[model samples]
Target: MVHNFNSGPSVLPKEVFEEASRAVLDFNGTGLSILEIGHRTSLFQAVIDEAIQTTRELMKLDSDHEVLFLHGGASTQFFQIPMNLLAEGSTAAYLDCGTWGKKAIKEAKLYGNVEVVASSKDRNYTYIPKGYNIPSNATYFHYTTNNTIEGTQMHSIPETSVPLVADMSSDILSYEMDFNRFALIYAGAQKNMGAAGVNLVVVKKDILGKAGRPLPTMMDYREHIANGSLLNTPPVFAIYVAMLTLRWLKQQGGVSVIEKINDRKAQLLYDTLDSLPVFHPTVAKEDRSKMNVVWVMDDPDLEKEFLAICKDNGMVGIKGHRSVGGFRASLYNALPLESVELLTSLMKEFALKKLNRICLRLFLSRHCGLLLSLPAR
Candidate 1:
């Protein structure tokens, strides 16, 4: 019973895992396993269709959008997006918040000029940068919706005339938002969605064929839109698992209900961190991420001991990213609230034990000094 809190490839609903497992053995009464079936057959075609349809349904997207399940992870889109939309001589604006945002900027620079409209690097990305100017002449305005490593999130969308592009790899589907606002949104299927190796892309159909340079067929968004994401052999297994997870989300009453549960789970852990004297949350209260809650202890020794206690309690992947050394509790849609409660209880217990040890030390020291001053024993 591992309480998984890993950042990516994170926890998923038990039902999703069970159903996907059954499909691997036998899919919809078909004689062949999902792994062994031909991808072009109607069986797998239905899987891809339903996955796309369910994604749009959950987000309430309209027919103007095209959904794609591509082979590469979200990183590939970092380059593919700029190639498709960014003209050679034009500039694109980006809000640089964390490591991923910086990575996206770097990739976009290779295709065209990139303007960093705003950045939180000065404060080590503790909060999302705001009140920045978006260049009017920029081809598009790009931003990462959630900073997984820094545990800060952009609560509101940035308003601008330019097309909005987002890399929502970590926080998509965890909460409800205006999916129609963005000209494009892409995510790796490992976090709030499902397994790795597949990237889900949603693009406004009209935005295609705008780049200055001609793109190869594979790199072109128009080609993917025309081919139904079957331009090549897709990551069949990963897409199937993602579809199952989407089904589970719909059964759990869609993103609206799931957002409430995620908010409750995040508040449980964050409130516990705030109440405990020794522990402190890393990000500012208003900008903290609902998907990943990060915190650290006052004493390094206590932090180590606390981690040991967490390991003993069947907790896994609670360790923070190396770049930012502190604990990160990822509260994805599938992570049950009980897991957060267990972690918060451990934090209270650990803080109390440390406080009691300090008080006992003070008591012993005072009494021993008094006795020594009065008479030798």
Candidate 2:
């Protein structure tokens, strides 16, 4: 079996995949493929409603919040969030911790002033910035909960009176957090939910209409909320797959239980990386992402050999982002612990072989001259 470690469009439960595949062929015995169903049909409506309801149930959200399934991925929210929340002349305090955080900052600046409260860019985002001051006058505090490229994560939710917003594309549903603390939370459906093309949003009801700006029909959160996220045709397949994944998550005893298993998998891989002399993790110990664990060989020259070993051993999507060239193992909810074990075992085997080769070379260097001088053999 292929061990998939893709950062997004990542691994998912086999049961979800099977159910989704069946739906694609013939949805719920309706004799129509999920792909062919109209978005307005009651059948599809049921899918959308259950998805929204299950999302609320899983997060334990109340009537104060509304769940939305939109067409664009989380990146669209970078613009829509500020559009719906940031009024002219107002400022949004952002913690520019990593790539996505930086992107969010850039988008927010288009609508209003953006205060970069804290950043770790100086260290190439090896760690999450902390102890930042959120501006009391700001519209909202924005942050990305996990950095997929840099493999750093914010373990604790920041306490602030200012409204909190998060781009949770890479970490949502992977762990438990205080969902009610955020004024808005958004995520792309690919990482922990489903395939691409859909973005899930949770927004506080009272926060809308406070931005004090005219929003286009599609750009306004209030519009989407009023229309039940059906102002236009949604990504039906993506939402269906996401619903299946959510059901699977419930069957596995929800986020709390999956978190324990995720923790175990991350610990196993990190421990092995620490034990092996050749392999070294890139991110700081305190900030390493449980979802995406990145590491490299101490000797950069051996990266090719190790990657080849990984390929031969049935591992895929272990290559790191281009900006940081190394290995990144994304341990999504569906990735089993045994996959982590296999990767760690490979690391140990590679380290042992390298050590043996070094020892052999040292022995030859020290004794070759003496042996040659004594006699030809």
Candidate 3:
């Protein structure tokens, strides 16, 4: 069996895949394929409603928080968030964890006074930046929950009366979160949810209509929420697939249970990496990510060789990001521990051989030294 560990558009539950496979051909009570169904049809409306309801249920959100599924990607929200929330004079305090956080900070700067409260760039983003003072009057504190490229994560949120907004594109639904504390939480539905066409935006109702700016119809969170996220045609298939994934998550004892399993998987991989003398984990221990584990061998060349061996052994998507080159094994919710076990076994074997070779070379060097230094008797 094969395991897919790609960071984005990553592994999905097999049960979700099986159900989605059938829905592609024939949807509920309708002969038309799910892809062919009219977005306005009652059948599709039910699908949309169930998805929104399930999302609310999963997050345990209140009436204050309304979930909206939109067509623009999460990157779109990089701008829309500031446009819809912050005004010309207001500032948003941002924490730069990695690539996505930097992008969010960059985009928000175009709309308002963006204060970079803290950043991990000085340290190569190996650890999450914490303890920076957020301006009490700041519009909100924006952060990315997990850094897929750098393999760093914010394990717990900073306490703030000021609103907290997160770009959870890579970590959403993989674990539990305090929905009440967030003013906004948005994720692109490709990684843990479904396909790439749709972005899920969940916003607290109290946070809207405060920006007081004229937002474009497509860019307005209020507009989408007002129209039930159906102002225009939506990515019907993507939402449907996401709904199936959510259903599967529910069946597997919900996020609380899945989190336990995810913790176990991450521990297994990290422990194996630490135990192998040749492998060095890149992410800092305190800020290590559960989703992405980045590491390298004593020799960069050997790391490349190890990746090639993994690919030949039926593993895919283990290569690290180009900017942070080495090895990154993404253990999204669907990646089984068996795949991790296989990778660990290979690492152990390779490390043993390396140690043996070192031992043999040292023995020869000492023997040569004795022969050269010995006096004629």
Per-residue lDDT over 68-107 for candidate 1, one digit per residue giving the tens place of the 0 to 100 score: 9997898999899999999889899999999999999999
Q: What is the lDDT of residue 48 in candidate 3?
A: 91
TM-score, candidate number 3: 0.95
For residue 221, model 1's alpha carbon misses the true position, in angstroms, by: 0.8
> Which segments of candidate 3 are over 4 A away from where they belong?
367-377
Model 2, span 1-377: residue lDDT tens: 89999998889889988988898899999999999999999999999999999999889897899999998899999999999999999998999999999988888999999999999999999999877789899889999999999999999999889999999899898898889999999999899988888999999988899778888999999889988989999899999999988888988999999999999999999999898878889999999999999987655669988999999999999999998888999998889989999998988888898888777666776887432232110
Tens-place lDDT per residue, model 3, 24-133, is: 88887477899899888898899899899999888999889999999888999999999999989999999988999898988999989999998899988999876789
TM-score per model over all chains? 0.97, 0.96, 0.95
Candidate 1's displacement at residue 10, Å, is 0.9
Off by over 4 Å in 1: 370-377
- Which pairs of residues collide in model 2? none
Q: After superposition, how far is residue 167 of candidate 1 from its true place, in Å?
A: 0.8
Q: Is candidate 1 or candidate 3 better by TM-score?
A: 1
Q: If both were scored by lDDT, which would come out higher, candidate 1 or candidate 3?
A: 1
